[model samples]
Target: MATETASREPRTKTRTTASPTVGAAVVKRTRTVAVRLTDAEEAAWIAAALVDGHRQLGAWVRERAVAGYLGKVRPKAGGGGLSPEDAAEVAALRQEMTKWGNNLNQVAKAINSGQVPPVMAEHLEKGWLNRCGQALARMADRLDALDDQG
Candidate 1:
């Protein structure tokens, strides 16, 4: 009768332990940072956070802090010095400059190899100089436009 009762009793299952990698992945953020602000400063920060569509001031501040740090450490293309459109324009200008440089090199090679007459070389030099001046003026205008936007 005792053996029969023991057989009828339910067996307990043992719990399995989590792997180290899984346990590490489940760890929660426990670090804290504190900041002190005056009443007016706190109020201003709260308003700014609200304006930025953040429900919590802490979240807003954290996002901004991380963004600012990332901007300083790994800035966007054009080194965060120029807006996207301006950066693209600068890239295009660089490409154009490279083409101009190649063209100048070809002209120089032609002149040095006596493949071009003196008059034609002079004409090519003058044409490239004019083109360079025009490019410079256009770049200056674009810079002025960017300044105005800023």
Candidate 2:
């Protein structure tokens, strides 16, 4: 009778194997990059990252590195690579811009400090406008040169 009752009981099934397709769509990150930094360098990088409001130092470094690379490799507007001559011209233009900026700052300071009479201020304003016009002309010439090269 015990054997009959045991035979009448239901059998239980067990699953011991995992499905092979369970994680098919998931990608594993296997690549890694390693860098050695001095204590001061690490601190400086961490400080900069924090100042930029980045939660992760590695992310900050990666973003900066990618940006720098893109800036160097990106082509100019006229579809030509940046040659040495182009680089020199750019540097000269930057210097000119800095000089003009300083001149404008001085003019503003003089005007604000009441160091110049109204008539003199008018003359200074005209001169500043002329300087700006000249800078624009120079930039136009450079653009023409670039057009010819392209």
Cα RMSD, each candidate: 23.8, 23.9
Please write out the lDDT profile of model 2 over residues 32-148, one tens digit for every residue.
Answer: 355777645555565455444443666666667776888633223344334545544544554566777787777778779979768767877678568776886787688568546
Model 2 global lDDT (CA atoms, 0 to 1):
0.56
Global lDDT of each candidate: 0.57, 0.56
- Over 96-138, each residue of candidate 1 has an lDDT whose tens digit, in order, gives 6677778767777887887997776677767866876688678
Give the least accurate 10-residue stretch of model 1, judged by summed lDDT.
1-10
TM for every model, in the order presented, reads 0.35, 0.36
- Candidate 2, residue 51: CA error in Å? 30
Q: Give the least accurate 10-residue stretch of model 2, judged by summed lDDT.
A: 1-10
Q: Candidate 1: where are CA atoms >4 Å away? A: 1-79, 117-129, 140-150
